[model samples]
Target: MPEHHSGRARRIPPTLAAGLISLLAVLALLVTLPGTATAGGVKRPVHPDRDWMGVTIRAHEDGAGPSAAAQLTASVEGVDVSSHNGSVSWSSLWNSGVRFAYAKATEGTSYTNPYFTQQYNGSYDRGMIRGAYHFALPDNSSGTSQANYFADHGGGWSRDGRTLPGVLDMEYNPYGDTCYDMSASELVRWIGDFVDQYRYRTGRDAVIYTSTTWWKKCTGNNGGFGSVNPLWIPRYSSSAGELPYGWDFHTIWQYTDSGPTVGDHNRFNGSLSRLQALANG
Candidate 1:
């Protein structure tokens, strides 16, 4: 599933969809400002030992840009193109710098991502490790059903000869009539149930992707899932100095929406080797 507008359920004129798609296509490339190593300086080599937990990230900048070839380290460095539409070139983008990627697999019970197989197979064929994610339903009745749909439809991670972990995208469903209506416990149960079933079928851990606000609001103090699975935390503004609370560790931190890619328009994500370690652990 490529990235799309959140409020897609509301009826939009066909013209609007085409216009939005074109807008996204252009915005994707312009949004990613070059990531500079230091302020007012040329791009420097990414220090493998530097702590990247809460770095202030941007995909592009106005003046000086980070040298494109500089290398940095954390653990696992990758991107999540689930939000990007299916038109992105996964192999070229991943080969640019991304070490691993997670593709959108299924959304609700009936809605499978149109690009799942293409991106999944594309990444695998290029020898870029990849994973799949199911956009979990916030509703109680459909949560389990959506999870099962992913398990059944999402191809085997092992079958592809890749080790990247599958993910359960637990963010708010933008299509809902009411905003932020689901309770914290309810979301946890929904997410937990999905992970349980996914593991049962795939024998692999399901990583959780959510924003700081969603986690704090929906899960509250309940960190039950944090103990068992690696979390992919999405914090848009915080700098590297501010440590995220509640979770013991995160597998990936989506630090910015602006990232450079050969043929992408919106944003990209970053992580460290810890992600791969989490997948193996």
Candidate 2:
């Protein structure tokens, strides 16, 4: 048996055997690496759990701009809530000057916020012009599928003058590669897929929620959606420093994750009536 195997093994070329050994060594090295795996030109691990908006930004780019209290300018106040926030107090937020709110509804095609009904409905019940947002997980499924799941869950919009358009939370990936293992153009296409399908489903252009750093890094600062989608920028600083390339202005600026009230605090770029007009539209 040993002689038979030796005869067969000798049939391989010396160069091919060397190449096979080298490839196995490379594979072994990758497998031994602690926290990263190669996918589509990026190195990261896949975490299928739901990650809320701004998770990556808070991890990587927090404190890059002015303090959260720097901008004393007058604007409509708001908050964005996720499952992390649990059941939010709508009346307390409203009384504390939160005129608008966004509750996380869905993530990917698999997860929906358990507290969505209470947060989304409670804000509206308290007379806040509220919207629902989907925390996008582009790596798990096609953008169209995620959009459908989001709209079907709680991310629907109505022109009742009290309901705002749904938001697409497009920040950095909480569980995987920063750009979901996609190239910049590919990420742009995914976003287009989501917004286009969302508009088809709800007849409203979805608001895009992202930070400038993640936008520039992942999308290569693509400006295609800026013409139609309102930008929701997260800064966590006093001033919303530089915006991504496509947007001239931010519709909503999420300035702080730790608000005095609850969840992330935001400021609309316009007056209360303008906010209403946005809701009506």
- Model 2, 81-144: lDDT tens digits are 8887888888888788788988888887767788889999999998899999998877767889
Rate residue 43 of model 2 by lDDT: 34
Segments in model 1 whose C-alpha atoms lie over 4 Å from true places: 1-75, 159-161, 177-180, 238-246, 262-281
lDDT of 1 by residue, 123-242 (tens): 767666677776655552445566678788873457434556677776544433222356767666776777787777778777777655545656775667767776776554442222
Clashes of each: 26, 2
lDDT for position 151 in model 1:
80
Alpha-carbon local distance difference test for all models: 0.55, 0.83
lDDT score of residue 101 within candidate 1: 64
Best by lDDT: 2
Best by TM-score: 2
- Models 1 onward score TM values of 0.64, 0.81
Off by over 4 Å in 2: 1-50, 64-70
TM-score of 1: 0.64
